[model samples]
Target: MNDSLHTVSLIKIALYSAFAFVLSVITVVFITPFFPESAHDFLRFLAEVGIVLAVSLFIVRHLNKKDVSLRSIVGDTSVSKKMLLFSSSLTIGKLILYFLFAGLVLRFFITQPEFAADAQSVMEDTSPPEFNRWLIISTVVLAPVIEEFIFRGIILNKWAEKSSNTRALIISSLLFGLLHIGSFIIPQFIGGLLYGIVYIKTKKLIYPILMHVLNNLIPVGIMLIPAPESTEAFSVSQLIAELTPVLNVVSLVFIIALPVFLFIVYRYSRNLNDEVAPFKFNTRKAI
Candidate 1:
């Protein structure tokens, strides 16, 4: 494709992503309030997913019409299997690292000692009847798939087109981090960085999806595990105190293991360029 055409395609993608983001925000803030709390939450989640997917699909279609595709965005596919393996490994490694980070931060650095107090408060406040089932669907399935499609698929794709790989990765990752501007901001930002690195290394959406799914799943799984009851009303400090001892040991183990895992992933991904070249070409041709 010509530079002019590529520029046009990129503009379309940016417009679509921006539109989806705005729509999602509006849905969450206003449209979601009419239904029952649980129903509203579920619907809002679905709406957000829909917006991203719809926008991404539109961009893909636009690209296809101009005879471009993922291949054009990613270029040649060599070592895809290796890339996949490395990506999966990196996802696991990062999860371990982040979990440990979250634990340690809660254990020591967080002034109030309620490491994820805000998240905990939201979860408690939004407790639904089938909380476990809903939580699994939202975290493991919905969040991972949809968020990856939006951040890695549309946003990163556009960034890669307009800038160097390093720039694209950093900008997209920063956007990912900033989007999670809530009480759990630090941990989410760390998670975003990990996901962005995997996306850039693999040039495939699946890696980030797996990483995101695991990131959400681990926390929800921990929440599912039974905990001792305290008579006092839940306070952030109290919650941190309850989990501090267990978190410290878990964090230490994960922190130790993460670097080893990351090294393996890095080594594996080094061979990916050659493997992905053919696949990328074929995909471009098909488009």
Candidate 2:
């Protein structure tokens, strides 16, 4: 378990992710065609879960080959109720920041008819009820668990062993953000960083996973709000106008609450650390 041989390289991480994605795609393609359209969503979900579980096991076994225990990677620290509460409050602040920034981008797009058309198209694409249902399950449920395990539970700890915690935080967050690609890059990246910090401070994989689920809940809740059944074409200004007031109020509240939440979390984290040292993986140990 020499440091030289302990690294989880970026290429390996990319390959692992791509392998899961490609395997899921292949499974869906091979299996879904035989099922009735009514059953496709459920079947697809099963396929995704199956593939992810299989890949996760494979990754764990691979790590075990190098003497890294899954328990160590996931950490041994106990999480407290107050810590979870403060962390969740901080996550709300992050979500508000996202919505405010999204509002700004929408406002900018309001000035450009061409961009508005593209935005309209994207909205239409996602408006399907079936798509929204699947998106909710995927985003709010599966993604937090799977992505947190891969990025924070595994990648961050291994990379910290190979390099340093700071570098591990930056690189893992960067990879997480890049996974979203396109316009989601910045927000997802920042979210990754926040989750990474929580993982480091709490030394518990469940904290970040729970926080990630909470962060996604707000957006999915908004998406689930029933829109008027209008046959009329989309209007960017109308959309912005309807959303602006709520976003502004929330953003203002977030601005005021964020610092308080940070202070509480910081204080609690310090107490937790004093009680039990934040677990670092034993990369130097061999079975």
Candidate 3:
């Protein structure tokens, strides 16, 4: 087995994820209660930063032992204006399609009250106002950097050493989806796949991170929008129930349009070599 693949095996990836989850639980269960409620969010944010740092240090230490610098795995490819625009457009189109399909499936196919409630629970973020700042910071900033580094930079590249890039992409993206399993699994899975593709095409972590930021920013921006006073407290289920008819029509349109949109994405992805990769980066050793 190659050194990179051996160092970052699937076992290590699972351990990394488990370590983060256990640490988070420890923070919430043990640490958060001691703090006044006002300080909980700040504490959680610090915990998140610590988790990222801890995981990163572990990865770096292992890779160094293998003589592989993190930067090489991350790649030093410079993203050009043209590649940036192309990647951004592709991400936006896929996101719109995902939103439509998700709405359709939830509103129409999944009709049992129990199942619907479970789905709604996944979508709902009931964090109080005190936590909003940290939530936003984590989602918009910490998430993209750490997640992209772990999934695309370390896991995907390491797996690609011993397996085909396609297999590595599927494995990395599947793990990514599971990380957000309860909350719109399909969309997260699709986003993972898209980010994986961007990483593969450009050989750069920055590209996928940029796309992830854009993906996350959309929901963050939506959350920031002031709702109508009357419906401010409505949960996703209630809102969906109220707008069922309109959503059904929109879903129908999306169902019809989805195939065409997918075809465009496929074509664009195939032509990415022409759009990106006109330049290259000399890989020097760096963490």
Top-scoring candidate (lDDT):
3
Best by TM-score: 3
lDDT of 1 by residue, 195-276 (tens): 7666665555666777687777776777777666656576666766767778779778877877777676566446432332
Q: How far is candidate 1 from the true structure (C-alpha RMSD, Å)?
A: 6.0
Please give each candidate's TM-score.
0.62, 0.74, 0.77
Q: Give model 3's clash tally.
A: 0
- For every candidate in turn, the CA RMSD to the true structure comes to 6.0, 5.1, 5.5
lDDT of each: 0.62, 0.70, 0.73
User: Worst ten-residue run, lDDT, model 3?
Assistant: 276-285
Residue 240 displacement in candidate 1 (angstroms): 10
Ranking by TM-score: 3, 2, 1
State the lDDT of candidate 2 residue by residue for 17-71, as single tens digits: 6788788888889988898988888877776777667767777667656655666
List where candidate 3 sits over 4 angstroms from the true fold.
Answer: 1-6, 106-131, 230-245, 271-287
What pairs collide in candidate 2?
A: none
What lDDT does candidate 2 reach at residue 195?
87
Candidate 2 wrongly placed segments (more than 4 Å): 1-17, 109-129, 132-135, 228-287
Clashing pairs in 3: none
- Per-residue C-alpha lDDT of model 3 across residues 120-171, encoded as one tens digit per residue: 7765755544326887888988899888888887777666666666777788
The positional error of residue 173 in candidate 2, measured at the CA in angstroms, is 0.2
